[model samples]
Target: MTLKIDCQLRDLDFTEVGTHAQKMEEMGFDAAWTFEAGQDAFTPLTLAAAATKNIHLGTNIAVAFGRSPFAMAQQAWDIQKLSRGRMHLGLGTQVRAHIERRFSMPFDHPARRISDYVRCMKAIFDNFQNGTKPDYKGEFYQFTLNNPLFSPGAIDHPDIPVYLAGVNPRMCRAAGEVADGFHAHPIHNMSYLKEVVLPAIDEGAKTRGKSVKDLHVQTMVLIAAGETQAEIDKAVEDVRMQISFYGSTPNYRGVLEHMGYGDLGKELSQMMRSGQMAEMPKKIPDAIVEQVAVIGKLSEVGPKVRERYEGVLDRVAYYYPIPKDAEIGNWKAFTDAVKHTA
Candidate 1:
């Protein structure tokens, strides 16, 4: 299968949005994404939609538990309209601590909660599309209020594709049950994906009389690459820290276990609880890094990524680091390489 390479803007620049989007589109990259980590996900895409044509845009993940279903539908509809139906809204139910402590939201039965949430959001979208009153009721959320005075009814594309971010089986299954696509967590390796994630999603789809082919599987590949071997080595070390951090999360330990590295995860979790951040990466050996991330010289990453994901992904996004103050954006080579022609 032919793969479509996508990238994300690390920094928000309204003035340079078109300049960047136009350049990426010309570079043959298929799409662009924004994250809800530290900034608003749609703002960058608002500028992107105004500036370019043809390139798709999405949120890598916006917190689903943080907002009401109607709010999500309204915002997603606006993005889809503004982007001319190029928006794919990606939602995620972050872990309980973040939900309860950070967002002050409840976290329980996440898979079932998200399933009901998506159902409610779609009902809202359907109401907007069909110009009817919102009359959807789910166990988690309900949208029964509708007034034409405030309703921005009927857009060019009411059915914006909804993708869900998932790392574990229940979330993966939930995505297969209701979402248009699945966003594989960056902490994942091929073995964890094959052995744990996809099979659960397949079963979820099967229960609904659907199949794996009905959902787009988009992976965020963690890679370590640079112009020189030294830079590559540093990047690898940096990514060991990243993987270690991911491993520290109890939910993600399953990935480490599936990869035969359960002991590594246990050590990292202890270090994390002790707040020994600097010493965490020391516990992750190079072999573990190799299993979790792609490592190569600048020219080699594209084909290598394609090799690893050949039968698995329909779309892939590269997540790596390049110094902002450097003379050139090192991620350029990664984008070009994944395009498979550079």
Candidate 2:
């Protein structure tokens, strides 16, 4: 399969999204994604839809429990119409603490919850498009009422694609069972993808009489790329920090343990609890850094990433902290290199 390059809109300002998305489309990006961090993920896509015609718009992940499935379907439905069926709805069940403490929402049985969530959304969309009865009853979410007065009737594009984000096996399997695609976490290595993620997804796919080939697989890759040696070193340092941060999270411990970094993961979590953030990155060995990230100069990054993930991923985007401006102007060279190389 030909690997497609994807990009992210990191700027919180919604005003600049249209122009940035326009540039991404012009530069030949297959899609642009937004994540739920400090701002709403849907608004930017709405703007991007009006600005670009062919480029796909999606949420890298919008928190699933943060809103009702019906509400999310409505937003995605509108964007699908605005973009003429180019919207992809990506959803994730955030960790328990965040869902309970932060969002103040229930977060039990995440794997099952998300599975039902996707089903509910599909049923709601079916009702909107085909006037199919919105009778979906699942373990977590149940939606049987859809008054026509509240429904956003049929449109040219009603079959919106749903992608689910996950790291653990259960969640990965759930995604394969229902979602149109799976979004791999950025803090992943090829070993974890091959040994754990793919197998679990395939297992879940089997339950549905499907396989990995039936779904789109995509991920956010950690890349340490720069034009100069000093710049490359700086990027590596940044990547190290990211790896350390992810390693400290309990949810991501499986990837570390699978890579023979179980002890390192425990140490990082301890350091995090001790408020020793400055010391965590220094503890990540060069071996772990190389395994988790693609390190090279700007010119070499495109080919190296393509070579590393060509058969493993159907699509990928470079993962990093988005600068304040978050314009695609600086990334044109990198984007061009990937397309030309492909």
Candidate 3:
């Protein structure tokens, strides 16, 4: 399958979101996504939906535990209507600490909770679209109350695609069983995807009488590509730091362990405990960086990514920082190359 290139809109200025999305559409991107970092994920997509006509809009992830299913379904339904049926609502079960301490929400049984969460959202969507009674009672959530006044009514495009973001086996399985697509973490190599992620998702898919091929597998790739060696080196260093940061999390230690870096994962966790965040990147070696990120010249990146993930992934986006205005042409070249490659 030919891999489609997706774009993540990171422009912080709300006023510039529509224009940025328009530029991505003109560049021939398949989707424009936003993450729940410092701002609301759904809000920007609403802007993008209004500003652009063809490009798909989605949340790279909105915290599923942070909002009720009703609230999330409401936003998704409105966007699907406004975008004329081009909204993919991606949800994530953020780390326990963030879900509990940061969002002041409960985080018990995250895997099951997220699975039930997706079902609940779908139930709500069904009720709105087909006038089906909202009577879904899952382990973590229940949706039995939906008055006609509370409903957003029916829309022409009510079949919104839902994607789940995960790294561990259980969550990957949950995505397979429940979601329309699975979002792979950037802190991963092909080995982990083949040995861990794909098998886990397949296992879950079997429970639902489906298979891995039934779901879309999208990943965020850390690409260290640049016009010059110096720029490439800087990008590689940035990717190394990102890998270290993500590998420190216990939930993601499996990826490191599978990559023969279990001890490094432990040390990174120790550094996090000791508040040595600034020194953690130095511990990641160049070899690890090369394995985790695609390193090459600007012209070589597209083909290298295709060679690495041609059949395994349906869509991919760069995990690096959004390119500056001057750097947009280079990114456009990468996207064009990805589309035209044999």
Each model's TM-score, in the order given?
0.93, 0.95, 0.97
Model 3 quality (TM-score): 0.97
Question: Which model scores highest in TM-score?
Answer: 3
lDDT of 3 at 140: 88
Mark the regions of model 1 whose C-alpha exceeds 4 Å error after superposition.
13-15, 321-342
Q: What is the alpha-carbon lDDT of model 3 when measured against the actual structure?
A: 0.87
Candidate 3, number of clashes = 0
Question: Candidate 2's residue-wise lDDT over 36-106, tens digit each?
Answer: 98889899999999999998889999999999999999999999999999999999998999999998999
| lDDT tens digits by residue: candidate 3, 47-119 | 8899999989888899999999999999999999999999998999998889889999999999999999999
Write candidate 1's Cα lDDT for 232-332 as tens digits.
Answer: 99989989889888889888888888877878778888898999999998888878888878888867888888888877878988674223343333445
Q: CA lDDT of each candidate?
A: 0.82, 0.87, 0.87
**Ranking of all predicted structures according to TM-score, beginning with the best and ending with the worst:** 3, 2, 1
Q: Superposing every Cα of model 1 onto the true structure, what RMSD results?
A: 2.2
